[model samples]
Target: MGNNHGSLKKEATQPQHSTTNNSKDEKKIDSRTEQSGKTLVDIPDDLMRKIIPYLGLIDRSNLAVTCRRFYEAEAKAGNSKNSEIWDSVGIDEKGKKVSMYKCFFEDVDDESGRYSIMRTKRMILSLKKTTPATTNAVIQRIFRATTATKMEKLEAAMQLNDCHSESQSEED
Candidate 1:
Protein backbone atom coordinates (compact mmCIF):
# COMPACT_ATOMS: atom_id res chain seq x y z
CA MET A 1 0.00 0.00 0.00
CA GLY A 2 2.84 2.41 0.91
CA ASN A 3 4.53 1.79 -2.46
CA ASN A 4 1.27 2.39 -4.31
CA HIS A 5 0.63 5.61 -2.41
CA GLY A 6 4.20 6.80 -3.11
CA SER A 7 3.77 6.11 -6.82
CA LEU A 8 0.46 8.05 -6.94
CA LYS A 9 2.12 11.06 -5.23
CA LYS A 10 4.95 11.03 -7.76
CA GLU A 11 2.48 10.86 -10.67
CA ALA A 12 0.45 13.83 -9.31
CA THR A 13 3.66 15.90 -8.81
CA GLN A 14 4.90 15.11 -12.33
CA PRO A 15 1.74 16.48 -14.00
CA GLN A 16 1.95 19.74 -11.97
CA HIS A 17 5.60 20.16 -13.00
CA SER A 18 4.69 19.53 -16.63
CA THR A 19 1.85 22.08 -16.48
CA THR A 20 4.20 24.75 -15.07
CA ASN A 21 6.73 24.04 -17.81
CA ASN A 22 4.00 24.30 -20.44
CA SER A 23 2.87 27.67 -19.08
CA LYS A 24 6.47 28.96 -19.20
CA ASP A 25 6.80 27.82 -22.79
CA GLU A 26 3.50 29.48 -23.65
CA LYS A 27 4.77 32.77 -22.13
CA LYS A 28 7.93 32.62 -24.19
CA ILE A 29 5.90 32.07 -27.35
CA ASP A 30 3.65 35.04 -26.54
CA SER A 31 6.65 37.31 -25.95
CA ARG A 32 8.17 36.34 -29.29
CA THR A 33 4.84 36.97 -31.03
CA GLU A 34 4.62 40.47 -29.54
CA GLN A 35 8.22 41.26 -30.45
CA SER A 36 7.71 40.15 -34.03
CA GLY A 37 4.75 42.52 -34.35
CA LYS A 38 6.94 45.52 -33.44
CA THR A 39 8.66 46.89 -36.58
CA LEU A 40 10.97 49.89 -36.16
CA VAL A 41 11.21 51.94 -39.36
CA ASP A 42 11.32 55.55 -40.47
CA ILE A 43 7.99 57.16 -41.32
CA PRO A 44 7.84 58.70 -44.78
CA ASP A 45 8.44 62.48 -44.88
CA ASP A 46 5.20 63.45 -46.62
CA LEU A 47 3.16 61.34 -44.26
CA MET A 48 5.03 62.80 -41.32
CA ARG A 49 4.18 66.35 -42.44
CA LYS A 50 0.48 65.54 -42.70
CA ILE A 51 0.55 63.83 -39.33
CA ILE A 52 2.50 66.65 -37.65
CA PRO A 53 -0.20 69.23 -38.36
CA TYR A 54 -2.77 67.06 -36.64
CA LEU A 55 -0.66 66.52 -33.56
CA GLY A 56 -0.55 69.02 -30.70
CA LEU A 57 2.37 71.46 -30.69
CA ILE A 58 4.05 69.66 -27.80
CA ASP A 59 3.70 66.31 -29.51
CA ARG A 60 5.10 67.73 -32.75
CA SER A 61 8.00 69.31 -30.92
CA ASN A 62 8.79 66.05 -29.15
CA LEU A 63 8.67 64.19 -32.46
CA ALA A 64 11.08 66.73 -33.98
CA VAL A 65 13.44 66.13 -31.08
CA THR A 66 13.34 62.39 -31.71
CA CYS A 67 15.45 62.48 -34.90
CA ARG A 68 17.04 64.71 -37.52
CA ARG A 69 14.69 63.32 -40.15
CA PHE A 70 11.66 64.57 -38.22
CA TYR A 71 13.20 67.98 -37.57
CA GLU A 72 14.08 68.46 -41.21
CA ALA A 73 10.64 67.34 -42.27
CA GLU A 74 8.97 69.85 -39.97
CA ALA A 75 11.22 72.69 -41.08
CA LYS A 76 10.70 71.93 -44.73
CA ALA A 77 6.94 71.75 -44.34
CA GLY A 78 6.79 75.01 -42.39
CA ASN A 79 8.94 76.85 -44.90
CA SER A 80 7.11 75.67 -47.99
CA LYS A 81 5.73 78.73 -49.82
CA ASN A 82 3.21 76.72 -51.84
CA SER A 83 1.76 74.93 -48.85
CA GLU A 84 0.53 77.88 -46.71
CA ILE A 85 0.40 75.28 -43.93
CA TRP A 86 2.11 77.57 -41.46
CA ASP A 87 -0.14 80.49 -42.38
CA SER A 88 -3.21 78.35 -41.80
CA VAL A 89 -1.85 77.77 -38.30
CA GLY A 90 -1.61 81.61 -37.88
CA ILE A 91 2.11 81.83 -38.61
CA ASP A 92 3.41 84.68 -40.73
CA GLU A 93 5.70 83.85 -43.63
CA LYS A 94 9.16 85.35 -43.85
CA GLY A 95 9.32 88.39 -46.19
CA LYS A 96 5.67 87.80 -47.06
CA LYS A 97 2.65 90.05 -46.67
CA VAL A 98 0.83 89.27 -43.43
CA SER A 99 -1.40 91.44 -41.26
CA MET A 100 0.34 91.44 -37.92
CA TYR A 101 -2.83 92.53 -36.11
CA LYS A 102 -4.92 89.89 -37.83
CA CYS A 103 -2.37 87.21 -37.02
CA PHE A 104 -2.35 88.33 -33.40
CA PHE A 105 -6.13 88.13 -33.07
CA GLU A 106 -6.22 84.80 -34.86
CA ASP A 107 -3.61 83.40 -32.50
CA VAL A 108 -5.50 84.74 -29.48
CA ASP A 109 -8.84 83.26 -30.57
CA ASP A 110 -7.36 79.93 -31.59
CA GLU A 111 -7.66 77.53 -28.66
CA SER A 112 -6.27 74.66 -30.70
CA GLY A 113 -2.77 73.25 -30.28
CA ARG A 114 -1.91 75.08 -33.48
CA TYR A 115 -1.75 78.25 -31.44
CA SER A 116 1.56 77.25 -29.89
CA ILE A 117 2.98 76.32 -33.23
CA MET A 118 1.79 79.63 -34.67
CA ARG A 119 3.39 81.55 -31.84
CA THR A 120 6.65 79.67 -32.19
CA LYS A 121 6.66 80.19 -35.93
CA ARG A 122 5.96 83.89 -35.53
CA MET A 123 8.77 84.19 -32.97
CA ILE A 124 11.15 82.58 -35.41
CA LEU A 125 10.04 84.93 -38.14
CA SER A 126 10.34 87.92 -35.84
CA LEU A 127 13.87 86.89 -34.90
CA LYS A 128 14.76 86.69 -38.59
CA LYS A 129 13.30 90.17 -39.11
CA THR A 130 14.93 91.62 -35.97
CA THR A 131 11.56 92.73 -34.58
CA PRO A 132 11.07 90.19 -31.81
CA ALA A 133 10.48 92.75 -29.07
CA THR A 134 7.84 94.72 -30.99
CA THR A 135 6.08 91.59 -32.15
CA ASN A 136 6.01 90.17 -28.65
CA ALA A 137 4.47 93.36 -27.28
CA VAL A 138 1.83 93.40 -29.99
CA ILE A 139 0.94 89.78 -29.31
CA GLN A 140 0.63 90.51 -25.58
CA ARG A 141 -1.72 93.44 -26.21
CA ILE A 142 -3.91 91.36 -28.50
CA PHE A 143 -4.22 88.68 -25.85
CA ARG A 144 -4.89 91.22 -23.11
CA ALA A 145 -7.76 92.82 -25.04
CA THR A 146 -9.02 89.48 -26.33
CA THR A 147 -9.43 91.22 -29.73
CA ALA A 148 -13.07 91.88 -28.83
CA THR A 149 -13.13 95.46 -30.14
CA LYS A 150 -11.53 94.41 -33.39
CA MET A 151 -14.13 91.73 -33.94
CA GLU A 152 -16.91 94.19 -33.12
CA LYS A 153 -15.48 96.73 -35.56
CA LEU A 154 -15.34 94.06 -38.25
CA GLU A 155 -18.96 93.16 -37.65
CA ALA A 156 -19.93 96.81 -37.85
CA ALA A 157 -18.11 97.21 -41.14
CA MET A 158 -19.88 94.17 -42.59
CA GLN A 159 -23.24 95.57 -41.52
CA LEU A 160 -22.49 98.89 -43.20
CA ASN A 161 -21.49 97.08 -46.38
CA ASP A 162 -24.76 95.16 -46.31
CA CYS A 163 -26.75 98.40 -45.85
CA HIS A 164 -24.90 100.06 -48.70
CA SER A 165 -25.58 97.11 -50.97
CA GLU A 166 -29.29 97.18 -50.13
CA SER A 167 -29.51 100.96 -50.81
CA GLN A 168 -27.78 100.52 -54.15
CA SER A 169 -30.21 97.74 -55.07
CA GLU A 170 -33.19 99.99 -54.23
CA GLU A 171 -31.72 102.81 -56.35
CA ASP A 172 -31.31 100.38 -59.23
Candidate 2:
Protein backbone atom coordinates (compact mmCIF):
# COMPACT_ATOMS: atom_id res chain seq x y z
CA MET A 1 0.00 0.00 0.00
CA GLY A 2 2.86 2.44 0.86
CA ASN A 3 4.62 1.67 -2.48
CA ASN A 4 1.37 2.20 -4.38
CA HIS A 5 0.81 5.61 -2.67
CA GLY A 6 4.37 6.73 -3.53
CA SER A 7 3.86 5.82 -7.22
CA LEU A 8 0.52 7.70 -7.31
CA LYS A 9 2.12 10.85 -5.82
CA LYS A 10 4.96 10.67 -8.39
CA GLU A 11 2.47 10.40 -11.22
CA ALA A 12 0.46 13.40 -9.90
CA THR A 13 3.52 15.68 -9.78
CA GLN A 14 5.16 17.15 -12.87
CA PRO A 15 8.72 16.04 -13.54
CA GLN A 16 11.21 18.58 -12.18
CA HIS A 17 13.03 20.48 -14.89
CA SER A 18 15.89 23.04 -15.13
CA THR A 19 14.88 26.58 -14.18
CA THR A 20 16.31 27.87 -17.48
CA ASN A 21 14.09 25.55 -19.54
CA ASN A 22 11.06 26.46 -17.44
CA SER A 23 11.68 30.15 -17.98
CA LYS A 24 12.03 29.61 -21.75
CA ASP A 25 8.70 27.79 -21.85
CA GLU A 26 7.08 30.55 -19.83
CA LYS A 27 8.46 33.17 -22.30
CA LYS A 28 7.07 31.22 -25.25
CA ILE A 29 3.65 31.09 -23.62
CA ASP A 30 3.82 34.80 -22.85
CA SER A 31 4.66 35.64 -26.47
CA ARG A 32 1.84 33.45 -27.73
CA THR A 33 -0.66 35.15 -25.45
CA GLU A 34 0.58 38.58 -26.45
CA GLN A 35 0.29 37.79 -30.16
CA SER A 36 -3.15 36.15 -29.96
CA GLY A 37 -5.50 39.13 -30.34
CA LYS A 38 -6.35 41.82 -32.91
CA THR A 39 -5.31 45.11 -31.39
CA LEU A 40 -6.77 48.60 -32.08
CA VAL A 41 -4.45 48.96 -35.08
CA ASP A 42 -6.25 46.11 -36.80
CA ILE A 43 -9.46 48.18 -37.06
CA PRO A 44 -10.03 50.02 -40.35
CA ASP A 45 -9.71 53.84 -40.35
CA ASP A 46 -13.33 54.51 -41.34
CA LEU A 47 -14.53 52.18 -38.60
CA MET A 48 -12.18 53.77 -36.07
CA ARG A 49 -13.44 57.25 -37.01
CA LYS A 50 -16.99 56.01 -36.61
CA ILE A 51 -16.10 54.64 -33.18
CA ILE A 52 -14.50 57.91 -32.02
CA PRO A 53 -17.63 60.10 -31.83
CA TYR A 54 -19.30 57.61 -29.50
CA LEU A 55 -16.51 58.13 -26.94
CA GLY A 56 -16.60 60.95 -24.42
CA LEU A 57 -13.79 63.49 -24.07
CA ILE A 58 -11.72 61.48 -21.62
CA ASP A 59 -12.29 58.31 -23.59
CA ARG A 60 -11.17 60.12 -26.74
CA SER A 61 -8.04 61.28 -24.97
CA ASN A 62 -7.34 57.75 -23.80
CA LEU A 63 -7.81 56.44 -27.33
CA ALA A 64 -5.57 59.17 -28.71
CA VAL A 65 -2.76 58.13 -26.38
CA THR A 66 -2.70 54.57 -27.71
CA CYS A 67 -0.95 55.20 -31.06
CA ARG A 68 -0.37 57.77 -33.82
CA ARG A 69 -2.95 56.24 -36.11
CA PHE A 70 -5.61 56.49 -33.40
CA TYR A 71 -4.58 60.04 -32.56
CA GLU A 72 -4.99 61.11 -36.18
CA ALA A 73 -8.29 59.30 -36.42
CA GLU A 74 -9.54 61.20 -33.38
CA ALA A 75 -8.47 64.51 -34.87
CA LYS A 76 -10.15 63.66 -38.16
CA ALA A 77 -13.28 62.84 -36.22
CA GLY A 78 -13.24 66.34 -34.77
CA ASN A 79 -12.77 67.85 -38.23
CA SER A 80 -15.68 65.87 -39.61
CA LYS A 81 -17.93 67.40 -36.95
CA ASN A 82 -17.53 70.89 -38.40
CA SER A 83 -21.27 71.49 -38.41
CA GLU A 84 -21.40 70.93 -34.67
CA ILE A 85 -18.61 73.42 -34.21
CA TRP A 86 -20.37 75.89 -36.51
CA ASP A 87 -23.62 75.55 -34.59
CA SER A 88 -21.75 76.15 -31.34
CA VAL A 89 -20.55 79.54 -32.58
CA GLY A 90 -22.39 82.39 -30.91
CA ILE A 91 -24.11 84.71 -33.34
CA ASP A 92 -26.53 87.40 -32.27
CA GLU A 93 -29.51 88.43 -34.43
CA LYS A 94 -27.42 91.28 -35.75
CA GLY A 95 -24.68 90.41 -38.28
CA LYS A 96 -22.14 92.14 -36.05
CA LYS A 97 -20.13 89.15 -34.78
CA VAL A 98 -19.76 85.38 -35.10
CA SER A 99 -17.53 83.67 -32.58
CA MET A 100 -16.47 80.01 -32.44
CA TYR A 101 -14.14 78.69 -29.76
CA LYS A 102 -12.38 75.45 -30.62
CA CYS A 103 -10.18 73.06 -28.69
CA PHE A 104 -8.28 70.18 -30.32
CA PHE A 105 -5.28 67.90 -29.85
CA GLU A 106 -2.09 68.51 -31.82
CA ASP A 107 1.70 67.99 -31.84
CA VAL A 108 1.56 64.30 -30.96
CA ASP A 109 4.92 62.65 -30.27
CA ASP A 110 4.40 58.94 -30.92
CA GLU A 111 7.70 57.73 -29.45
CA SER A 112 7.42 59.58 -26.16
CA GLY A 113 3.61 59.30 -26.09
CA ARG A 114 3.33 63.03 -25.54
CA TYR A 115 0.51 65.19 -26.95
CA SER A 116 -1.04 68.64 -26.71
CA ILE A 117 -4.63 69.84 -26.64
CA MET A 118 -4.76 73.36 -28.01
CA ARG A 119 -7.67 75.73 -27.44
CA THR A 120 -8.23 78.59 -29.87
CA LYS A 121 -10.62 81.49 -29.38
CA ARG A 122 -11.64 82.39 -32.90
CA MET A 123 -13.33 85.72 -33.52
CA ILE A 124 -14.60 84.86 -36.99
CA LEU A 125 -16.23 88.24 -37.10
CA SER A 126 -15.79 90.79 -34.33
CA LEU A 127 -18.52 93.01 -32.84
CA LYS A 128 -16.47 96.23 -32.89
CA LYS A 129 -15.13 95.67 -36.40
CA THR A 130 -17.15 96.24 -39.58
CA THR A 131 -17.31 92.68 -40.94
CA PRO A 132 -19.37 91.24 -43.78
CA ALA A 133 -23.02 92.19 -43.53
CA THR A 134 -24.01 88.71 -44.69
CA THR A 135 -23.36 86.36 -41.75
CA ASN A 136 -24.05 83.36 -43.99
CA ALA A 137 -21.16 84.24 -46.30
CA VAL A 138 -18.82 84.74 -43.32
CA ILE A 139 -19.92 81.46 -41.76
CA GLN A 140 -19.45 79.65 -45.06
CA ARG A 141 -15.90 80.97 -45.41
CA ILE A 142 -15.06 80.09 -41.80
CA PHE A 143 -16.19 76.48 -42.21
CA ARG A 144 -14.56 76.13 -45.61
CA ALA A 145 -11.12 77.13 -44.39
CA THR A 146 -10.42 73.70 -42.92
CA THR A 147 -6.64 73.74 -43.29
CA ALA A 148 -4.05 76.23 -42.06
CA THR A 149 -2.99 77.03 -45.60
CA LYS A 150 -6.59 77.70 -46.67
CA MET A 151 -7.27 79.79 -43.57
CA GLU A 152 -4.12 81.84 -44.09
CA LYS A 153 -4.93 82.47 -47.71
CA LEU A 154 -8.47 83.46 -46.80
CA GLU A 155 -7.14 85.86 -44.15
CA ALA A 156 -4.66 87.41 -46.59
CA ALA A 157 -7.34 87.96 -49.19
CA MET A 158 -9.67 89.50 -46.64
CA GLN A 159 -6.89 91.78 -45.43
CA LEU A 160 -6.00 92.82 -48.94
CA ASN A 161 -9.61 93.66 -49.71
CA ASP A 162 -9.85 95.68 -46.48
CA CYS A 163 -6.68 97.61 -47.37
CA HIS A 164 -7.87 98.35 -50.86
CA SER A 165 -11.26 99.57 -49.61
CA GLU A 166 -9.58 101.75 -46.98
CA SER A 167 -7.34 103.34 -49.64
CA GLN A 168 -10.33 103.96 -51.93
CA SER A 169 -12.20 105.73 -49.09
CA GLU A 170 -9.09 107.85 -48.42
CA GLU A 171 -8.96 108.84 -52.11
CA ASP A 172 -12.66 109.87 -51.93
Candidate 3:
Protein backbone atom coordinates (compact mmCIF):
# COMPACT_ATOMS: atom_id res chain seq x y z
CA MET A 1 0.00 0.00 0.00
CA GLY A 2 2.89 2.38 0.82
CA ASN A 3 4.63 1.55 -2.52
CA ASN A 4 1.42 2.30 -4.44
CA HIS A 5 1.10 5.70 -2.70
CA GLY A 6 4.72 6.50 -3.58
CA SER A 7 4.11 5.58 -7.25
CA LEU A 8 1.00 7.80 -7.35
CA LYS A 9 2.95 10.73 -5.90
CA LYS A 10 5.71 10.25 -8.56
CA GLU A 11 3.16 10.15 -11.39
CA ALA A 12 1.54 13.35 -10.14
CA THR A 13 4.93 15.10 -9.88
CA GLN A 14 6.00 13.86 -13.33
CA PRO A 15 2.91 15.42 -14.94
CA GLN A 16 3.64 18.75 -13.20
CA HIS A 17 7.25 18.75 -14.58
CA SER A 18 6.03 17.82 -18.08
CA THR A 19 3.44 20.58 -17.97
CA THR A 20 6.11 23.10 -16.97
CA ASN A 21 8.33 21.96 -19.89
CA ASN A 22 5.40 22.22 -22.29
CA SER A 23 4.68 25.77 -21.18
CA LYS A 24 8.35 26.69 -21.68
CA ASP A 25 8.34 25.15 -25.14
CA GLU A 26 5.20 27.12 -26.04
CA LYS A 27 6.82 30.35 -24.84
CA LYS A 28 9.90 29.63 -26.96
CA ILE A 29 7.71 29.07 -29.99
CA ASP A 30 5.91 32.34 -29.38
CA SER A 31 9.20 34.21 -29.07
CA ARG A 32 10.52 32.60 -32.23
CA THR A 33 7.40 33.67 -34.15
CA GLU A 34 7.88 37.23 -32.87
CA GLN A 35 11.55 37.23 -33.90
CA SER A 36 10.69 35.99 -37.41
CA GLY A 37 9.94 38.89 -39.73
CA LYS A 38 6.66 39.33 -41.54
CA THR A 39 6.20 37.19 -44.66
CA LEU A 40 4.37 38.20 -47.85
CA VAL A 41 1.18 36.68 -46.51
CA ASP A 42 1.42 38.84 -43.44
CA ILE A 43 1.33 42.04 -45.50
CA PRO A 44 -2.08 43.53 -46.22
CA ASP A 45 -3.34 43.41 -49.80
CA ASP A 46 -3.79 47.19 -49.93
CA LEU A 47 -0.20 47.71 -48.86
CA MET A 48 0.96 45.10 -51.35
CA ARG A 49 -0.86 46.91 -54.15
CA LYS A 50 0.99 50.09 -53.31
CA ILE A 51 4.31 48.25 -53.23
CA ILE A 52 3.70 46.36 -56.48
CA PRO A 53 4.21 49.48 -58.59
CA TYR A 54 7.74 49.80 -57.21
CA LEU A 55 8.70 46.20 -57.98
CA GLY A 56 10.28 45.39 -61.33
CA LEU A 57 8.80 42.92 -63.80
CA ILE A 58 10.91 40.03 -62.46
CA ASP A 59 10.19 40.87 -58.83
CA ARG A 60 6.48 41.21 -59.53
CA SER A 61 6.43 37.91 -61.39
CA ASN A 62 8.36 36.26 -58.57
CA LEU A 63 5.81 37.52 -56.06
CA ALA A 64 2.95 36.41 -58.29
CA VAL A 65 4.33 32.88 -58.47
CA THR A 66 4.90 32.77 -54.73
CA CYS A 67 1.21 32.11 -54.08
CA ARG A 68 -2.30 32.70 -55.34
CA ARG A 69 -2.83 35.72 -53.10
CA PHE A 70 0.11 37.63 -54.59
CA TYR A 71 -0.89 36.61 -58.09
CA GLU A 72 -4.39 37.98 -57.54
CA ALA A 73 -3.06 41.11 -55.91
CA GLU A 74 -0.71 41.80 -58.83
CA ALA A 75 -3.41 41.26 -61.40
CA LYS A 76 -5.69 43.72 -59.64
CA ALA A 77 -2.97 46.33 -58.91
CA GLY A 78 -3.12 47.74 -62.47
CA ASN A 79 0.66 48.11 -62.61
CA SER A 80 1.00 46.00 -65.73
CA LYS A 81 2.04 48.78 -68.07
CA ASN A 82 2.97 46.41 -70.89
CA SER A 83 0.16 43.90 -71.17
CA GLU A 84 1.47 42.75 -74.54
CA ILE A 85 4.72 41.50 -73.03
CA TRP A 86 2.72 38.62 -71.56
CA ASP A 87 1.12 37.80 -74.91
CA SER A 88 4.38 37.06 -76.75
CA VAL A 89 5.16 34.44 -74.11
CA GLY A 90 3.19 31.19 -74.28
CA ILE A 91 1.53 29.15 -71.62
CA ASP A 92 2.78 25.67 -70.79
CA GLU A 93 0.57 22.58 -71.21
CA LYS A 94 -0.19 22.90 -67.52
CA GLY A 95 -1.65 26.38 -68.18
CA LYS A 96 1.32 28.04 -66.48
CA LYS A 97 3.03 30.87 -68.32
CA VAL A 98 6.70 31.70 -67.87
CA SER A 99 7.68 35.35 -67.40
CA MET A 100 8.91 37.03 -70.60
CA TYR A 101 11.76 38.69 -68.74
CA LYS A 102 13.16 35.28 -67.73
CA CYS A 103 12.88 33.96 -71.29
CA PHE A 104 14.05 37.04 -73.22
CA PHE A 105 16.15 39.23 -70.93
CA GLU A 106 19.89 38.39 -71.08
CA ASP A 107 21.05 40.25 -68.01
CA VAL A 108 19.76 42.82 -65.55
CA ASP A 109 22.66 44.94 -64.24
CA ASP A 110 20.91 46.16 -61.09
CA GLU A 111 17.51 46.88 -59.58
CA SER A 112 17.47 50.41 -60.93
CA GLY A 113 18.61 49.25 -64.36
CA ARG A 114 15.97 46.53 -64.35
CA TYR A 115 13.30 49.05 -63.36
CA SER A 116 14.38 51.35 -66.18
CA ILE A 117 14.29 48.51 -68.69
CA MET A 118 10.86 47.49 -67.50
CA ARG A 119 9.63 51.04 -67.83
CA THR A 120 11.13 51.34 -71.32
CA LYS A 121 9.70 48.06 -72.51
CA ARG A 122 6.30 49.05 -71.18
CA MET A 123 6.24 52.49 -72.76
CA ILE A 124 8.22 51.87 -75.98
CA LEU A 125 5.77 49.62 -77.84
CA SER A 126 2.91 52.09 -77.38
CA LEU A 127 5.08 54.88 -78.79
CA LYS A 128 6.46 52.75 -81.64
CA LYS A 129 4.59 50.79 -84.31
CA THR A 130 6.46 47.51 -83.71
CA THR A 131 4.52 44.44 -82.59
CA PRO A 132 5.40 42.13 -79.71
CA ALA A 133 6.41 39.40 -82.20
CA THR A 134 9.01 41.71 -83.70
CA THR A 135 10.38 42.60 -80.28
CA ASN A 136 10.57 38.94 -79.19
CA ALA A 137 12.25 37.92 -82.43
CA VAL A 138 14.79 40.73 -82.04
CA ILE A 139 15.60 39.65 -78.50
CA GLN A 140 15.97 36.00 -79.60
CA ARG A 141 18.23 37.09 -82.46
CA ILE A 142 20.56 38.84 -80.05
CA PHE A 143 20.87 35.69 -77.99
CA ARG A 144 21.50 33.61 -81.09
CA ALA A 145 24.16 36.01 -82.27
CA THR A 146 25.90 35.86 -78.91
CA THR A 147 25.84 32.04 -78.94
CA ALA A 148 27.17 31.94 -82.52
CA THR A 149 30.04 34.24 -81.63
CA LYS A 150 31.04 31.98 -78.76
CA MET A 151 30.86 28.90 -81.00
CA GLU A 152 33.01 30.56 -83.63
CA LYS A 153 35.67 31.41 -81.06
CA LEU A 154 35.65 27.81 -79.78
CA GLU A 155 36.03 26.45 -83.32
CA ALA A 156 38.86 28.82 -84.14
CA ALA A 157 40.73 27.84 -81.00
CA MET A 158 40.25 24.13 -81.72
CA GLN A 159 41.55 24.55 -85.27
CA LEU A 160 44.59 26.43 -83.94
CA ASN A 161 45.36 23.47 -81.62
CA ASP A 162 44.58 25.74 -78.62
CA CYS A 163 47.82 27.66 -79.18
CA HIS A 164 47.70 31.38 -80.02
CA SER A 165 50.95 33.23 -79.48
CA GLU A 166 50.54 36.69 -77.99
CA SER A 167 53.95 37.93 -79.38
CA GLN A 168 54.47 37.50 -83.09
CA SER A 169 58.32 38.01 -82.84
CA GLU A 170 60.57 35.98 -80.47
CA GLU A 171 63.82 37.43 -79.11
CA ASP A 172 66.80 35.10 -78.39
Best by lDDT: 2
Ranking by TM-score: 2, 3, 1
TM-score of 2: 0.33
Model 3 Cα lDDT, one tens digit per residue, 7-98: 22211111111235455545544554457743446667778778887777667767766655666667666444433333333322221222
Model 1: per-residue Cα lDDT over 42-159, one tens digit each: 4466666666666554455566555555555555443332224333322333323335444533553464444433443344343323343433343333233222354553444344
lDDT of each: 0.40, 0.43, 0.41
Model 3 Cα RMSD, Å? 20.9
Instruction: Report clash pairs, candidate 2.
Output: none
Quote the lDDT for 39 in model 1: 21
TM-score result, candidate 3 = 0.31
TM-score, every prediction: 0.29, 0.33, 0.31
Ranking by lDDT: 2, 3, 1
Clashes of 3: 0
